[model samples]
Target: MSVNPVVRISKVLSLLTVTLLVLAGVSACGTSSDSTQDTITIGASLSLKGDFSDSGLGLKKGYELWADNINKSGGLLGKQIKIDILDDGGTPAQVTTNINTLIHNHKDSLVLGEVITGLAIPGFETADRYGYAYISPGGLTGKITAAEKDDNKHNVFGISLPIKSYLSSFDQYVLSLPADQKPQTVAFMGSQSPFATQQLAFSKAEIGDKLKVVLDAGGSYPEETTDYTPMAQQVVNSKADIVVLGSGSSAEAGAFIKAFKQQHYNPKALIATGGPDEGKAFLDAVGGADTAEGVFVPNSGWYPQIKNYQNDVFTKSYVAKYGGTADEIASDTVQGYAAGQVLEQAVKKANSFDNAKLQDVLKSASFDTVQGPVQFDETDHTNKVAIPFLFQWLSGHLQAVYPANEAQANPEYPKKTW
Candidate 1:
């Protein structure tokens, strides 16, 4: 049965070649499977329509900037992350519907979304319903954070401005003032708004025996607001030096500030708790740094002072990749990026898309944002709090002036009481 030597050699070579082919095919499949598993899914709910459209679009772009950059870096946890977006059309009812769909579709996708706080409330509850961790990129209300402790708040989280807490924190400085400088009575004025409600809730909790609120005045939105002059005069007559604004960007606030100055009832402190937008717009609208000059615009961070912040990695890379000058964009974009980073971290830690697991990871999660380290409490998820920087209009820019440690520039007002 012995074959010729040449034939035997040929047969042996053919067997070796077939064995190698089988091994190569198996190796190729293993690589393909690994590649498939390396992908992670992230989702968002944005207001793509209705009022607040301009700001909503800006927020969407900000989130995209972070998500795209992270994916470019091959994503987190050895997985290439993908972001899925849904537009809520700026209606709470519509927002609720969108959330339903998002949770259904992304029951498996990690949610990285926000509703512009005032209008995006339904989407917030949606996160609560599905137990999916969603970072609200622009919504800042304490009620939302309080919801985290409720049975319905399992997946609710936000990286938005702490407008309420910052307001209360700012009042601490007001309370500590020497008795002579501190006002015996104060005024709380706000345009009628949900934002105002949060401001009031926070004030009730924090404003101590320092100043009494004499004039509890407010204006309705776009109506009953024929003029804010009367309200302004009332605030002036109350002899209150400290005025806590209710809403962040109330046109009435600017009008009141103007009226107060015109009547020569300058207050020692004009504290605004709205996002930087309201603060900037009001300061700019009031004209002459001297008119709204002595006032303080309270916010977490603005891009101009970001160079002094500890977030060099993101700030540098973001400014370089994004076309806008860092001076022009909100330093808040850094926080938006930090939120995205949190999502990345959760996914890596969870190692699976199980909503429960992701929720667990976000719970008790403590990590660094562009501003500072953020830790979520089991009962409360408000993370990353820093001293509110009071920006006084110095030169043409709103520069940080408080906490001497972070004073980028000197205060425009050494002291004032109108």
Candidate 2:
């Protein structure tokens, strides 16, 4: 049965051709599906190992929790999300490097997370240049977004209160207070950072003819200094009726309050903005619940004690997962969750992962999340209602004490003297 050599060779070539064609068909199908489907990837940069590490870790937890929930619900657009993150070490240069790595190396679709205000500019610049839509759950620098918008850089959105609105709104609330309760004189103190300075300027403008400034003491103390006694002494000497401290961090804010108390110079009201007044850390830093009495801070997130439909839902879920009350969770945690919510909603409304389309959805839509209604102004990307009621420390917990309807307890108007 031996065949001619040419005929045998011809038969072998035909079989090889058929086998190769079948293999090519299978390969093409696999490649097609891979190109069109799979997990969606997002990128984030945070100060996970440096000065702002606590809040940065909180933000990461919030993002992870949101991602887990979405995946459990069958994922977004039928694809699971993978968040690629990097620690920036809380430096502007490091932030810039991390952002570049995320955008260029990882080729991620979106950017999220928080960096300190002073260190965020480079990140903003990178997002703009690359045209990756970005949002932060915690950054509050109005000028960053405002400047970007002016230059036609519309890829950025900030979830926290805008610097302008944050200062003006607080002053507006003070002005709305009953005439007799309003303090005649005020003292302003804080880090001399750009955001703090802007806050002071805006508050001064809002309080025109309404209050007098006795001590404009701030920026005098370097951020590295732990002892705020020198600044506290100036504030005490001024005998200001009201004291407003715009601290850069919880530790600094707590130090200022402790120093003020140690000096036995308690003003009628001592209101503070920034990290220190937000949650448990500051209270603990200043020597526990008993010593933290009467301190007032804005209720930026709906705490567990607040009775609201949204608050109940978030509180229940958060407590069940983390085994702690709402106040125990870092304030930035809620913010990071809110940011993920906004991003998910935007993705759904747009029905596309295209940056331009997502940006359009963000600018036009209002999302109702655990924090409440989130609406952004397209011009500057400022949140319309980021900050809600003001809360005062009562007993060992924070209680809503303003707007009557939202008040959980009566406010200690004069803030008790130490």
Candidate 3:
């Protein structure tokens, strides 16, 4: 009862077509539901209140701007990525609670925000426990990454430059000068914050035995120490040609400048590292920019024209949303936005959001973000490769002065005679 060869072939062809059609239907259905799979969650933790609010606020705005720009542009992976923000009121206790809350709230998957290094010190375990990828935008504590030698880190990524970011720049800046103008004797200053000691030590390691650090004094800058008469006089007596102030607050630098100026001893060079605003505040509090002429500091993001984080679209939308000019932006915002872009690219590359599928897709993830080229090291889930710029204060404004070609302005000394 064998069928004819032609009939048999016809039946086989029909079955093949039907099977292909069924697969097509299933794939189409999956495509239709991509909206569900495209959704990715990002997280943030920062001080919304208390002492560090100014920078914290800026960090928040940066994150929001990053998130807003992404969401407006149809999001990533064909789905809108939602940012889950938690304010940690500038206290370690609050930070711990917020991390726990975000991990619990997100139900397993998680993203990270700026938590003071000290506060986040204990929470890495929680992230490892939950399989969350954590990125820190602001904390530069070198230990964060160096600790990778231990088992606590796998998903932890630190976007900010290590605490040593400033040490080399300041050292190089001084040494780069003509040998005649180089600063062989300098002063290192910071108020007695818990982090201050480590910062000074880091700066000194670079100084080595080559430079003479005349004054390495610190005290609480937030309290009522109106006059810096003693500290200034120390700078004067030591005949320090340079001053490197590393206070987290400007008032500390202002006091040192005022006291030093009164003594009629202006050093050959002065450098500060509280970012741009801190430099300006120091100038404002200590008469004007004239006295603090020869200072350099690190700043946030690239200029808008460069189309970096301050790109045309991001700049326009950020100003419009925040109701202010876009001159000042935190690196955190750039980092936050970059994180979103990473998630988006990962989701799209995966072409499916089965979490497991997403993981495979992101393992080799890379993308062009507002900050620049972003990618992750598989062993360590951090955007470790992107660093910050060294800014110099010339005339009245802070400008990028490192990397040779990126020099927006050149270094100069007002009181330090050439």
**What lDDT score belongs to each candidate, Candidate 1 first?**
0.59, 0.72, 0.59
Say which candidate scores most in lDDT: 2
Q: Which ranges in model 2 have alpha carbons more than 4 Å from their true place?
A: 1-37, 168-170, 177-180, 222-225, 299-301, 305-310, 385-388
Better of 2 and 3 by lDDT: 2
Q: List the residue pairs that clash in candidate 3.
A: 157-382, 192-219
- What's the TM for model 1? 0.73
Per-residue CA lDDT of model 2 for 1-418, tens digit only, reads 8889999899999999999998865543201222246787778888788667777877887888778778878988887888888988787788888888887677676778573566566776777666667777854575576567567777777766666545553565678779888889998887776656666667777774679988776556655566777787788888888877767667777887788888788887776666544567777778888768887665454656654325565666677777766777666777788788889999899887766678888889888666666788767777876765566778888776765666778778787878
**Per-model TM against the reference:** 0.73, 0.85, 0.74
Ranking by lDDT: 2, 1, 3
- Backbone clash pairs for candidate 2 read none
Q: How do the residues 1-418 of candidate 3 rate in per-residue lDDT, one tens digit apiece?
A: 9889999999999999999988865553212223346665555667677656555666676666766777777765455656666777767677667766766654424455563555455455455455555555543465555555476555555544455554566676666677676677877766554345455676677774668877766443432355656656766787877776665546666666667777687677666556344433445666765665656665333544455643677768776886544544444455555555555565578775444454465557666666566555566544446555666555655567775666676666534432
Candidate 1 residue-wise lDDT, 298-355, digit = tens: 6665435455334565656656866644444553355567677666666667775555
Better of 1 and 3 by TM-score: 3
